[model samples]
Target: MPQIKSLDELRNLRQQVERDISTRRHTGTTIIVGMGTCGIAAGARDTMHAILEELRKREIDANVTTVGCIGMCAKEPLVDVEQAGQPRVTYGNVTPDMVPRMIEEHLVKGQVVEEWVVGRLQSS
Candidate 1:
């Protein structure tokens, strides 16, 4: 870490921090679905479609992406939600039917559905 010498440096640091926060918070929500072989066998594609449909229906702007298995085979069909500055929440064994409420509660309302949360990645 670099030393802070003057108040101007401190102010500049604060501004940089604020810009980072705003960039993170305003970049929009991202939903990542695990699409590995196990996830596919467990119906992750349906879950992804359901999530996309819900977002379209609600007119919520978000990015829906896919990733390979995170080594949680038994917990196939895993879904990870990252809402701006919030921590990323991972849900296991997710079904298409659960997408709507996940969207409403987590993406739209900024509340994690604790019942379905299997893991949480804290923001740095």
Candidate 2:
């Protein structure tokens, strides 16, 4: 690590750390998968893996993350997408098979895959 020589340097380091945390906190497009025990049993791991693979293949820049149960235990494998200035769309019972289309249409084309959506949370 480099030694901090001035207050400006400290400020710069702080800004960089904030940016890094923000990137991990959320991206322009965020893909959040439920990874709780129920979600895992419902194949959420496979769903998450598929989403990551598709993002890489398509060259999409988005934050992919996992969260605890979404309160809908029956909808264990739920996936949520939150894009800038858009409502967060939650999809229930997600499967690895639906990942590609979800990414292509929703993430790439800015369209919601209404067929898979269980609910939407409007942006605040």
Candidate 3:
């Protein structure tokens, strides 16, 4: 391994790591869980864990992320989902119980669960 003793060398290593991560970034599907204080208090971490466990059990390829709040603490545990060529959909008041249904409707069937969606958007 190349020596990384200097601060400049460390910066270069950091840049290289960032570049590698950017190259491997997921292009098809994603689920972003808001992880702000309110979200965590409302059990977003549990919701996120449930979602990830389901993905693992089902052997699905989905990129999950913890994101900053979208200024809707009233709707804590918000989740945003996006797929290739699909409009990004946001869900509010997420809970562990909702993860399975989300995976079924959004990931598998390509249909949004309007009841859980943040707004009155079509299920397509």
Candidate 4:
């Protein structure tokens, strides 16, 4: 952890930790972005930024994480959305432009973006 030089910094760190814990506790929803070399080359960083921005703009709470290669080079910049009791859906060839609709439809409306989905895994 970084050194906390002031009380305000401590408070900010506490709030961030609390939010992380809360998000972890609510494992129902998670957004995973691929960050491997191929993914990064395909603009995963921008997609991730867009996802975060959209979530914040919509006041949505979700656990966003990153993963290494999943062996789908053709489908670089893959994004996965996992919700409680629902299949984990992976959207391939994701771009920053798609984040807003994906967030609105998947997170806010509780509907998957079927057309973008390339894979699905049931929770064990």
Residues 18-55, candidate 2: write the lDDT tens digits: 86776655557889999999999999999999999999
The runs of at least 3 residues in candidate 1 whose Cα sits more than 4 Å from the true structure, single-residue gaps closed, are 1-25
TM-scores, one per candidate: 0.78, 0.78, 0.74, 0.84
Which parts of model 3 are misplaced by more than 4 Å? 1-27, 120-124
Error of 1 at 79 (Å): 0.4
Which candidate leads the pack in TM-score?
4
Q: Count steric clashes of candidate 4.
A: 0
Off by over 4 Å in 4: 1-24
Q: Residue-wise lDDT of candidate 1 within 5-30, one digit each (tens)?
A: 77777788888778666565577888
**Local distance difference test values of all predictions, in order:** 0.90, 0.90, 0.85, 0.90
Best by lDDT: 1
Tens digits of lDDT, candidate 4, 9-94: 77888887886685567565889999999999999999999999988888877879999999997998999998888889999999
Error of 1 at 24 (Å): 9.7
Worst 10 residues of 3 by lDDT: 19-28
C-alpha root-mean-square deviation, each candidate: 12.0, 6.7, 6.5, 4.3
